[model samples]
Target: MTSPTTPGVPPPVVDLDLGGRTALVTGAASGIGRACALRLAAAGAKVRAVDRDADGLETLAALGTEAGGAVEPQVLDLTDLDAAEAAAAGADILVNNAGLQLVRPIEAFPPDVFHTVLTVMLEAPFRLIRGALPHMYAQGWGRIVNISSVHGLRASAFKSAYVAAKHGLEGLSKTAALEGAPHGVTSVCVNPGYVRTPLVERQIADQAAAHSLPEDQVLADVLLKDSAVKRLVEPEEVAEAVLYLCTPQAAFITGTSIALDGGWTAH
Candidate 1:
């Protein structure tokens, strides 16, 4: 006779079943944010993708439709609090993914550069969360996922502002999770290693010029050198992580920094 299935274990469920839920993802025009918009849409959630780039946002909306899903595209500068609040109205999930990074030595890091990075990366997310929490509390269910970075968990050279913003985002997530707990809302931080996107591509080009080395070698040796996998993360891989956390199985998983860093910090 076959033994009964264990109580704690069940069959694998790949699809997230997010019907009736609405997820608002910032920076959804491209890269990991774009991947996340598509992933959440495919999971059966209504999507609202926010970005400054109208063209890219439209493209993402079309991709969502092609994936048997659909998104309402909103063109807005996330740094503007009014726009962020307007966009977040009635949303059940908030993905704070809009960020800007400018890498240079501290001395060369202009004050203007710092302001832009902080405003976009940290302040916008803070405002978005603050704006979304009240609605989420009233609804009795919500998810706030902040996309930090491996640099947030640790540190690296020539990236002071970006690192600081990421670290602060993690702190914000923890605090938000603690407060949202009583209201049945959830919050989490997703820290991914460097992925090959246009953003990262620009970084690579800038690094090549600065270090006088080939871009490929810089990526292979410097970026992923300490990582166990020694490879840049794929956008789709990060998207999978986002969907995993959106599932009911992750109900108890909040107030944590989940890393998709190819074991970068495991060393």
Candidate 2:
């Protein structure tokens, strides 16, 4: 037989089959969330793509259709806690990825923005997990993947809200893992350093202003300063980690975080 591996092409990280699984991915309109949604769909899971961006959801749905994957777009703003919880019901796999950020000094940070950030990033996840747990417990098989960040493990200046929320998420994830273990469900966090996404792109301006540097210099002197890899993580890489967690081989891997931080945490 010819070589099983195609030259210059890497094989899939995991040979996972989720044929009858129903996966719910928040922020599915873009970036890591979108990558996870599509990856799950490609693996035969029926993906419910949730995002507030109707146009983006449409685009994702179209792309999913073209790839012959089942992706149903759910236009939702995760801030609406009731609806967010309701939308999560019956999901076998839940990826809590929707988030917003504001880079500012603690004293200068707007209280309203702080509240909004926690509401969307932290509270919404609590509700979503609450809704998903019943079905997961009943089925005795479920995956709860929380998209956290390196900030969850380490603190950085001018990212008060994001860091605080991520820290809280890590604790929440561990708690869920403890509770869900008896039910055969797993909860884990995937922490990436700084992924190239619209969220990071938007932060460049604020980061520049905060550090008194040119926008171009923010990536080198600021964002990647502590990263040994000296480059941004890709959304697909993070998505792959999330996918691996949902596999049977990862059944015992719970209550912890997979850090894709480019050695940021090693410091």
Candidate 3:
């Protein structure tokens, strides 16, 4: 394992500063998106918190203000592709975190749900990235962080739409990284395994039904079964990784994924 401390350097510190930066975070009403918005704001960035949940955005903005961070709430449904693109313009940091999930086998999945999932998860990110790139290229500095999941890397039964969208996001992130590098922008994905968030909580019943297990057994028998950690990853943990990817120290680390999977992928 790599040593915790670098030779001749003090232990790492959380002193990242983004004083003059502006960040746009999608799905900022809750879960990983909410955490990322707060984390970026805490680092001194003016965060534009975008979501369809107006009340949740208001709550998040108030919490961010209490933490001495600037959080501007923007109510948006990502299905409006043009608006999603427009919302990303002029952002120094763009976090593509908005997503929806539907658990069903490919054959049984509704076409409409699959299309909606793809539009929100995959297409919105592309539009946001498209809108953010010009400013980034002109300024020659930017960060694009896609909040992907372990589903982006590994497939699970009964999650066809989610898995397909995530896999597409992984590819899109890489392409952005390659195209952004010369202009001093970095694009990367932060993949966490089954984060302890409202989204995951909502999926428990569906997972149980799919696996024919009890709802109480879903967490241990289905969700965490492949995870060596035996617990759901926290949204804050994933947020921390997203924050790190935006720092100067991580400038050269792009076109790759930082997995906070707790050894789920090891097997």
Backbone clash count, each prediction separately: 0, 0, 0
Computed on alpha carbons, the lDDT of every model, listed in order, comes to 0.86, 0.94, 0.93
Q: Model 1, which residues run further than 4 Å from truth?
A: 1-15
List residue ranges in candidate 2 displaced over 4 A. 1-15
Candidate 1: worst-modelled 10 consecutive residues by lDDT: 1-10
Model 3 clashing residue pairs (backbone): none
TM-score of 2: 0.94
Per-prediction TM-score, please?
0.93, 0.94, 0.95
Worst 10 residues of 2 by lDDT: 1-10
Give the local distance difference test score of model 1.
0.86
How far is each candidate from the true structure, as Cα RMSD in Å?
2.9, 5.4, 3.2
Candidates 1 and 3: which is better by lDDT? Answer: 3
Off by over 4 Å in 3: 1-15
Which of 1 and 2 is the better model by TM-score? 2
